[model samples]
Target: MNNEQRLLLLEKAKQFFRDEIVESHITRACAKAGKLSNYNVNPFLFKYLANFLKGNDDPRSIAEALVLPRVLGSSINTSFGMRIQKLISELFEGFGSTTPGIDIEFIDAIDGSKKYCQLKSGPNTINHDDVETIFGHFQGTINLGRTNNLNIGINDMIVGVIYGEEIELSSHYKRINERYPVIIGKSFWHRLTGKDDFYFELIDAVGDVALEVDGTKVLEETIDALSIEIEAKFS
Candidate 1:
């Protein structure tokens, strides 16, 4: 569907669940969640309803629960940017997808640069014990030794990039020698999921991107656009 069509569909879907219903769901959800101030009301309520109405239920329910606030904040009623940012920050720090049950340290140790950059922001340390707070979340971990040793050359680094919901891209460094040896290792693992599929790439030293995940070139522009969005948001 086109962008407009998709938007319209989302709006229509959102309209199916009015504010009253959402509010009611939130009330019940808050009670069920009980004193969890940082709890995501939308997802909680969505899952609750999904438990009752089990058919073709997707993340749309959760998305719809967000629409009202999104609209209100987008309108002249309020500046939802900060609130949205706060929610996102909490979601990531408290319940980000990177590590579902186990929280990883989001340290400001490096940037896009391949050097020991000063830690501008403090690291967010998460431990394994904090997983049960969120019911459904998972993530994978890559085990690379502490030493700068690897089966591959120091310059040769294999990496996996996860995009959107479930889109994962695995590729090796094209120019390992030209870049620093940074190992994206996992100290722990968590259960996390996504909607988008993964794209695996084996990057050679010559900067060539080889599709390692199912050899197929889908909409390259779409992927480029998605990456641009991630960079813009993360940068």
Candidate 2:
């Protein structure tokens, strides 16, 4: 697609997230769980949410804030991580086919290689235990694929750390790294979009959409509405 078309699609995706995901899912879920109710409401939470909504220069923080509200309250206990995974998957689907699985499956357009992707938002998000567990599952999948004579294997898998610097890995992590290559930051985005600056372009596109949509106004209105509702419930 041309640059204009790509940007238009990105705008549509952001709007869909704001309307369908944030409004329909996150806001409603928070309301249902009484997140803004007097019993659960507090100045600190209010201030934090306000600050998050105000805006951040960091693209990752912007993306997270846009979706964080949806997973609050009862939704927090279920599907929180999955929700993020799905969002990332859908975002990449703009470039390639992102199929559902324990890890995301992306079919590279240039080489037709199917990459089974394990994504983490930050380096610290996955700890040593989490790495071991993920490696175990990934290894099992590779073995199962080999046993079934499938075309998938360790060569087709990648662990991507999205919004952080490269992590310091222990000996165990090093072994896992040897088996399944890990890519971080710019390399990860380059692999996904086959472009050197896809990450920056994406951030720019999202920022443009944010400005057009007046996200800060929407957030302020939302907070005000919720605060009034909570006050009414208490009064």
Candidate 3:
């Protein structure tokens, strides 16, 4: 990528982190968390587990249980994943896709070929049903392309995982890769921007944005809310 394009991409990346990560961090992090009513607590299990505790007492363990997993769960992942699909579409100047399995159709920046990509946030994001859905959509697209006299081929189809290496991918992704090309991490970014260094550059931009944006207020509020629930139950 040229200097101008690099600058624009960096600006977009910063804005995305602000909106998706910083702005949504509050609600997204505590979506199913904070309030006791929001989660189903297994006091029996906690009691059993906390029985084995020495310095770590029951109340503290319960409090941690009430907050940690709920905050760390897939709420943020799902929202950020959806936003990533939109951002990637924009970055590639992609067209809105009519194909069911495809997110967007765009000219490959590096090779100048038409690419139909099914975008995922990470390697292990998909499951068995998703596997069926992707295959069904891909096959349907192929049949339609043939009928329409299009030049679409298996090589034109791509499964794009925004992060992770092939060896570390889950079974679902490995299965998908068996049928179609899987581009991920640096390779995925390189294909889009035609720069070997674009991946590292984007990572640097993400790090800079993280350093600039503050989410302490949201985090504090979430902790306060969770603490209230903990006190009510433990007191």
Best by lDDT: 3
Give lDDT tens digits, candidate 3, residues 1-235. Answer: 7999888987888787877776676665664466667766676675554445433545555655556555556666776787877777556564668787788777777788988888888888889889878888888888889999997999788888888777778888888889988888888888887888888888888889778856566555665677677677767
Q: Output the worst ten-in-a-row residue range by lDDT, candidate 3.
A: 49-58
Estimate, for each residue in 41-77, the C-alpha lDDT of model 2 and write its tens digit: 4535544554667653232333234335543433543
Residue 158 deviation, candidate 3, in Å?
Answer: 1.0
Off by over 4 Å in 3: 47-54, 58-61
Question: What is candidate 1's CA lDDT for residue 142?
Answer: 20
lDDT of 1 by residue, 126-161 (tens): 123422222122111222322335232222221211
What Cα-based lDDT does every candidate model obtain?
A: 0.26, 0.56, 0.75
RMSD (Å) of each candidate, 1 decimal: 21.7, 8.3, 2.6
- RMSD score of candidate 3 (Å): 2.6
Model 1 CA deviation exceeding 4 Å by range = 2-4, 16-21, 33-164, 167-235
| Between candidates 1 and 3, the TM-score winner | 3
Highest TM-score against the true fold, candidate: 3
TM-score of 1: 0.15
